[model samples]
Target: MAQTTDLDLVHVIKRFGSHTAVNDVSFSVAPGEFFSILGPSGCGKTTLMRMIAGFEDPTSGDIRIRGKSMIGVPANKRPVNMVFQSLALFPMMSVGENVAYGLTSRGVSRAEAEERAGRMLERVGLKGFGNRRVTALSGGQRQRVAIARCLVLEPTLVLLDEPLGALDLKLREHMKIELKQLQATFNTTFAYITHDQSEALVMSDRIAVMNQGRFEQVGSPRELYHHPATPFVASFVGETNKWQGEAAGAAPDGTVAIRLPSGTMVKGQGRVADRATLAFVRPEAIALAQDSSSLGGLPNRFEGRVSAVLFDGANSSLLIDAAGFDEPVRAVLPQAGPLAGIQVGAPIHVGWTVEAMKVFAA
Candidate 1:
């Protein structure tokens, strides 16, 4: 027998006046899967999430949780719990009280609620912290409390709306792993929404890249990064050097040749278009060498001068003023290699294989 789906949206659409907030969005989450909807602000991710939570009505289509339709369900009556960016924990309540709030309000006895809440807190690494006021906890601790509160209700689905957005950079990074771990520990279905690509890439089992009120693509992070279905997915999900060019034609081996405005010809993989096309190369895929001979005879090679070096510890990159390109090319700089000592204004040769480049119709 087929397993029941955890959460499903079928042809979901929402509009305020003529502006479509969510347009024919449809997908499903499997049981215990960590699924994320990722996009920039105002792309309608929040509106889609609101419709799923029953705070807003869809203009058309259906939403289901565990095979039951939620078309006319109210938020409080639905089997869904949400953790918002604000967390919404009561300022006056202790950690345990906050976790137990839903249970007590739903007629669970105070003793049973406290016991359940305490168990949930301990499961979330907040053992023995039940009596502390929420304000006294650190940002990360408070986040755990918020998650514990939602999970204690044993809802069929938990929806998180950029829950880590309020934390500092370091804490946000930490929480991504922590949240993923908690989901695995509980085997709970999580529907996470975020604008941060890193958060979605690091934590989600599967991700749907949303853009302009629709999902551009849906797949695993590696599939979205290494094999993007749309030009928007290629550009938005990661950093890459892009060029507007004209398609010269296709090779026998299925590679497309693109002629840039500067007269430099490059080859890549993609559907061949008749005229306008876009090419993209990841920074890490470009190899830097002191001279052309060291490039091992790559299909595409360019000589350029280092314009600037952006140092972000292990994620450092060098900006190169390559000949025949309007914008500077970015190449990753290894931390302990001979190229690391190369200074600004130094001449360098950059090379990448034809397969490393991705081309798409404009």
Candidate 2:
């Protein structure tokens, strides 16, 4: 069975004079799915969102919602709602009034609007607080109110533009879970855009990694993390140690050997076409060995002196100055192991398998 597409963009291109913001991008969102566009600033993610919301017209291509064209539709006429980073909840109105604003504007009876607002508040876990002033609510409560305000209108798609960007670190972490729960509870299609990889990975069913003015890759969090399609996607989606090198040639086992500028030979699994290649090994993929023998039969091995210990609780890592490499190699240390107490200037062995190294043509 083919699942209904809630939103579809066909070769969408948005250009400003000579500069193109979004260049021939196309994708679709399944009904009730939580999709996210993740990228750095000025990556055209927000511009794409604005186009979908009808605020800006695309220079080319088409946008459809529920199989209906949205090319000529106005912002207010679209069956979509946008929740901004600021939330934009009305401080002057009571929580109930704020949530009912859209319904009341559409000629719904005041009593009916209030009744629906109350139910919506309950659904968002703010039960019995409709009559309270918006100023009295906490940050997370205010976010829920903003969402309720949009949901009250029964929009087919909800666009959240970095809705958690304004919250503190702890609150943002807490709200990520709450936001996913709310989205699941409603079973509504959510198109989220954010620069935070953690937020996108934690909440999205699938993520579109955007760079410059286009999507570099789109996949589930695990797929993007484990098998990034491009060098940008590999470097942007997570923490990794990247080294630039030239392709030395392919080995019998199909692993391509790369000769780094530092004259270090490292082998990785990938198609090596371009002579200029970039290799990425995730911090967690490199294992620290007490001795050369501890590396077993790993293909790539190096000895280095510990330069620094980055302590982040269970996420502690080590910065090692490996011989023949100008840059330090970062490797994750086990939370509790014999190497946990490794100190600066201590000599250590680090090694990784060819499969753990992702090689891409630069």
Candidate 3:
């Protein structure tokens, strides 16, 4: 027998007066999968999440949870729960009370609710924390409390809308792994929406990259990073240096060339020909050397001076003002390599293979 999906949206469209918030969006999340909708702010990711949470209704199409239509079903009646950015925990309530609120409201009985809430608190690494005030916990602790509150309901799907947006950088990083672990522990479907690409890349089983109220691409992290289907997906999913140019047709080896405004020619793999095009090259893909000899006759080699050095430990990089490119090209700096200590204003050679580039029509 075919297994039913945990959540599914079919050709869903949502509009507010003249503006279409979500346009013909469709996708499905398998049982226990951690799926994320990734996009920039106002790209309609939040609107889509709201629709799934029953806060907003789609103008067209259907939303299904565990094989049943959710049309006209109120938020409270749906077999789903949402954890918002603010968490919205009651300030006056104790941690236990906040977690047991939904159960008590449903008449689960005070003793049963407390027992369930206590077990859930321990499951989230907060044993003996139920009697503590919600205001006394740290940011990460509060985040887990919020998640535990929702997970205790054992809903079919859990919708998270930028739940970590309020945390500091260090805590947010810690919480990402924790959230993934918690989701796995429960094996419940998670439909997360986030504007931060790093969050989606780190935590999602599959990501749907949305833009301008439509899905740009949907694939695994590796597939999206190595084989982007659209320009928006390429630029939005990761850090890439973008260059505008004109397509110079394909080479005999099936690689397409792009002619930059500086009259420099570069080759990459793409189908765009004889039109305005954009080329993308990742910082780590470019090989940097003191001289071109180290690059061994690479097809795309440029001599330039280091315009700046950005240091982030293992993620350090150098900005090169390469010849023939309008903006500086960034190259990764290995922490233990010979070029690791290279300084600004140093002459450098940067090169890459045609395989490292991605070209698309503008």
How many clashes (backbone atoms < 3 Å, residues ≥3 apart in a chain or on different chains) does model 3 have?
A: 0
Question: Taking the tens digit of each residue's C-alpha lDDT, what string does model 2 give over 138-223?
Answer: 99999999999999899999999999998999999999999999999999999999999999999999999998889999999999
lDDT of 3 by residue, 48-150 (tens): 9999999999999999998889999999999999999999999899999999999998889999999999999999999999999999999999999999999
Off by over 4 Å in 1: none
Candidate 2's C-alpha runs over 4 A off are: 1-3
RMSD of each: 1.0, 1.3, 1.2
- Alpha-carbon deviation at 308 in model 3, angstroms: 0.2
Q: Report how far residue 295 has shifted in candidate 3, in Å.
A: 0.8
Candidate 1 structure lDDT: 0.94
Instruction: Evaluate all candidate structures by whole-model CA lDDT and list the values in order.
Output: 0.94, 0.94, 0.93
Q: Write the per-residue lDDT of candidate 1 for residues 259-362, one digit (tens) a residue.
A: 99989988898886458998999999999899899987799999999999898988889999999899999999878878987789999999999889998999
- Superposed by TM-score, candidate 1 places the C-alpha of residue 292 at a distance from the truth, in angstroms, of 0.7
Model 3 residue runs over 4 Å out of place are none
lDDT of 2: 0.94
Question: Rank order by lDDT, top first?
Answer: 1, 2, 3
